[model samples]
Target: MSDVDQSQLFEFLCRMGDNTLVLGHRVSEWCGHAPVLEEDIALANTALDLIGQTQMWLGLAGEVEDKSRSADDLAMLRDVWDFRNVLLVEQPNGDFGQTMMRQFLFDAWHLAMLKALTGSCDDRIAAIAAKSVKEVQYHVERSGDTVVGLGDGTSESHRRMQKALDLLWPYVGEMFVADAVDEAMAKAGVAPDPATLRDAFDARVEAVLTDATLTIPDGGFAHKGGKTGFQHSEHLGHLLTQMQWLQRAYPGATW
Candidate 1:
């Protein structure tokens, strides 16, 4: 690969890593505040798994970039616009229903992407994907089950859950849009073509939604951006301010 290609790959990996790290942090905020104790524990566990994956991916990204910065540095120091994650992950956890719905959508996509990534020619990324797929698979199952229960439970629960799903649906398109950087890495077998995973992702998500007795929203505008060099939703800026404050204030400090 050319120098430019390698640079793009490194940046791309960091974006992927940072997205997980930031979203994990956001989810962790609900640790003690979930509607049920079981759910609190489940969300907390999933958050930890995501953060663990973020550490691995960010470390690999740092190595590829030949940078001395640690995963913490890469995660906590980046500006909002610099973040490469799809907007779905960063959307606010509005309520328990919303959170579960968001997780269901994001994790389905994540599982498909990671499954394909397991065969990447970039051994570092492939190894990370192989290790992470186990945890993410479980996350998808748990979140999908929650969505089903809520969506098919009481009428109120079903209404709220469906609304949550509708709110999050627009952000789904950004996940599968492969850009120049993605194409370059894919050509080198360093990255999976995310588009290839879309059908599988749709099938998995559709199965879950069908089981939940939920109707997939049809032909909404499908909001896009926050990947391939586009601006993020406003929520991301507030998230970054809170996440980066300590790192920026105490530059080299350690706990």
Candidate 2:
């Protein structure tokens, strides 16, 4: 790849990494607040896994970018528009059911994407994907099972789970839409074409929802502009403010 292409690739990877890091932080916020003890453990474990993956990806991105910035700097210093994560990850955790639904959607897509990424020509990304696939697989299973259980549990539970799924459906579109950056990476065999993963992701998620006795919500409105070049939701500003406050308030301060 040319230097320009490599630069784009680095930015892309950093975006991916930052997305995971931010979402992991959000999920970790639920550590002690989960509705049940077992779920608390499960969500916490997933949060750790995501954070670890973020570190690996961000490290690689930093190296590729050839900038002096540390992963922490890249993660904490980027503005909301500068962020490349899908909006789904930044969406508020509405309820226990909503949170699970969000995870279910993201994990299912990420698992397939990561599986394909394992074969990428970019050895660094491939290695990261190889390591992350195991954790992502478990995350999908746990979230999927919960989605099924709650969807079929009772009238109230079913209603909440379905509503959760519906509310999250719009954000799913951003995950599969490929852009120029992705196309360049795809040609260089550095990244998977997200469109290719859509079918498998849909099949897997649909099957899980079917078994859960849940309906696939109509994806009427598509939520775009979180990853590529679109504006983010208001929630992202608040998330970044909280995340960056300590670092900005006291530069170079450490525990």
Q: If scored against the real structure, what TM-score would every candidate get?
A: 0.96, 0.96
In model 1, the clashing pairs are none
**In model 1, which runs have C-alpha deviations exceeding 4 angstroms?**
1-4
Alpha-carbon lDDT, every model = 0.86, 0.87
lDDT of 2 by residue, 1-255 (tens): 453387789868976797788789889889899998988998899999999999898888888878787778788777887888889999998899999999999999889989999998888889999999999999999999999999989999999998998888999988998988888888888888889999999899989999888898764577988887478889989888887898879877778
Candidate 1 versus the native: TM-score? 0.96
lDDT of 1 by residue, 117-162 (tens): 8988777788999999999999999999999999999999999999
Candidate 1, after superposition: displacement of residue 174 in Å? 0.4
The 10 consecutive residues of candidate 2 with the worst lDDT sum are 1-10
Which residue pairs in model 2 clash with each other?
none
Task: Report residue 76 deviation for candidate 2 (angstroms).
Answer: 1.3
Predicted structure 1: lDDT: 0.86
Clashes of 2: 0
